[model samples]
Target chain A: MSRSTPLREVHETLGATLTDFAGWLMPLRYGSESAEHNAVRTAAGLFDLSHMGEIFVTGPQAGEALDHALVGNLSELVPGRARYTMICATGGGVLDDLIVYRLGSEEFLVVANASNYERVAAELTARGEGFQAEVDDRSDQYALIAVQGPRSQEILSSLTDADLAGLKYYAGLPGTVAGVQALIARTGYTGEDGFELFVAAADAVSLWQELAKAGDGYGLRPAGLSARDTLRLEAGMPLYGNELNAGLTPFDAGLGRVVRFDKPGDFVGRAALAPLKDVPPRRRLTGLVARGRRVPRHGYPVVLLTDGTVVGEVTSGAPSQSLGKPIAMAYVDTNLSEGLAVDIRGSHEPVDVVDLPFYRRSK
Target chain B: MSSIPEELSYTKEHEWVAGLDDGLTVTVGITAYAADSLGDVVYVQLPEVGGTIEAGDAVGEVESTKSVSDIYAPVTGEVVEVNQTVVDDPSLVNSDPYGEGWLFRVRIEGTPEDLLTSEEYVTVTSSEA
Candidate 1:
């Protein structure tokens, strides 16, 4: 049986198609997914991200514990800010990608993927055993709502006096939204600017209703996981199960910059990742745009157009609403660049090797 | 619930057949239930005009945003004509699956077998849903 989010009733009333995602019943879409995707690009869209796990770490040694348990210099992260980091196995294989928010001097919120949060919480508890920090999984007690897109700031301003303009990217602050206490974070997975409000589970429905009312004229639609996938793909962001896995390190995914070898103390994957830093990886994550309408999907073999020799594999793919073509992220051989084709089903569809970000939001 | 026309014949695969009584030629398209399940139609590959196809043969494909489904030939026949408008604008499949979204016209070689009546198709969709 799948767990239901606090906003499950509201989603049902909106006639959303609910599906089981990561052991939780989540909305796949309310209506046309393409329209929702377009709304996020042109106007704004609301997302129920309560399925994301929020693991709280507190005490005097919270920063130290995180620095040792995961990669990145979390101890140096300023309060009220967030860092996109990852936890890895001893062999440098990624356990999960995380966003750590520094709530205060001794408090930090580690947002994890739903599927891996329980294991991540256990890992953090075990890793912080010698330190003076405590790890608690508060995922079930919180509900997260995100308003993302061009007009997100305007829509969010109508309901909260949280100084939306002063809140820089990757920053969070405690504020009251629609008379409900929330941790208003200016962070989102979508490529556009947005605000993620973390509130108590009981206040979710009313907050969502207020936000929806405020965004009525701004063309805010209730977007689901389908649109979220396409939007993130176009932004060239990595999904944990698709891009990051236990078999590959950060360097293999072309995200070696996120690993801070210079940070003090020996992290979980420090030794294994240190040696691989200077050495070029065999397969580098690359982007591909389809020449034809056929989409290059996940697990599809990327082969050489010349002799059909397999060179790489697609990790994530979708028909891009922004690019108006099929786009994909694949880990291809570092030595090969051009003359690539993704073997889609029985036919090999030609593709061009492009830069990592298939689309970038204009500033 | 999706609309199932009483005048049309339906296949278990969620395809509807029309013009069955108007000579040997019949029009075929996916049902609205199938279209809603597909989310948004991005591309449509239709069987070639004048091409020979057999019943249950996978002749074309409909690609959606998240998944792809095969368009099976409903009746063993020669493809008389393909809908060029739907081929150019695949959104027609989601916007008008029963009307302008008709996939192809087939001149039947033999009577289509195992087709369900409107009432029977309703039961099939209800069970699946």
Candidate 2:
């Protein structure tokens, strides 16, 4: 049986089309994907992210423990601050990418994806030999809801006393939302101004209801996993299963900044990541936009114009909600960058190699 | 799923066939119910005008964000004309599902049974719940 989130009933009640995803029943949509995508872009949107995992690390030297398990320097985090970090195996492959929340001097919360919950917990617990922190997987006890878009602050600020404005990006604060004590983090997967509210499992439904009601006038519609994927893809963010997996390192995913080699202590993947810094692999992921309306699908082969030789395949492709055209992200050989050819049907068309992040939010 | 206009015949593949005054040409399009269920039609790949298709064979493809569905031929026929409007403005299917959204007109050669009535379709989709 697939695991159900606390808001499962709420989604069905709203006529959501549900599908099984990564061992969990997730909502695919309530109506049209185009309308839902526009809602998040032009207005506000709500999402039930209760399927995400929340783990806690608490002890006398929790920072020391996190510094060892993560590739980033956790010692630099002050209380109430948070940072995006990745957990790696001993060989330097990624275990998961998560947010490290410094709740207190010796307390921290690591928010991970739902599918990676068990793996993240087991790896962290097993790697706790030299550290003084206790690793506890508290995923079941908590629920997450994200209010995203430009007007997210105006809607969320109505119920919270935490002074949401003072919270910078990647910062977490203790606050009360919908009459329940919760943790509000100024972070989200969507490339919009939003907050990820962590509350007790039982309080999730009421909080979502309140957020939806309060945000209704602002065009806040409940979004499903389908729109979430489009938003993240437009933001040029990586998905765990699609982009980052256990076998791929942070460097391979164009996230080299997360790897902190300056720190004196050795991380799990430090030795393997050392040589990659100077000379990375030849294959790189690049974004493409089709000049015509022909949108490419996933797993479509990219070919070289000179010899019709297949070089790479599309990892993710969709009709861009923001770009208003067919955009794609594909893994291409580094030697084939700048100007490459993508096989749409039987014909190969030229594609320009721009920088990473096909779309950027205007200031 | 409106009246199915007593003048028109229904196909099990969810298309409505209107026998035109020119006996050999039959106007064909998907029903409103089918279009509504498809949500917003983004892109469609249609067969050439002279392409021959067998009964139950997929003559084209209709794609939305959530799904990519095959447009199966209702009867053994040759595609004589296609709506180019869908290629430019695919939303025509959602706005005017039964009219401007007609996928194509076919010069059917043979007639098959199993086509449901309007009342029968109402019973079929209502129970599809």
In angstroms, the error of model 1 at B94 is: 0.4
| Candidate 1 lDDT tens digits, A194-284 | 9999999999999999999999999999999999999999999999999999999999988899899988898999989999999999998
* Tens-place lDDT digits, model 2, residues A1-363: 989999999999998878788888988788777788788888888988888899998998788888888898887799999989999888778889999999999999998888898898887887777788999998999989998888899999888778898999889899998798899999988788889999999999999999998897899999888888888888888888777888888888878899999875777788888888877766787887766666666778887778889988777777777888777788888777754677876768666666758767664
Superposed by TM-score, candidate 1 places the C-alpha of residue B67 at a distance from the truth, in angstroms, of 0.3
| Residue A254 CA displacement from its true place in model 2, Å | 1.1
User: Candidate 2, fnat value?
Assistant: 0.31
Q: Give the C-alpha lDDT of model 1.
A: 0.94
DockQ of 2: 0.46
Clashing pairs in 1: none
* Docking quality class, candidate 1: high
Among all candidates shown, the one with the greatest DockQ: 1
Which ranges of candidate 1 are over 4 A from the true structure?
A: none
For model 2, name the residue pairs that clash.
A92-A269
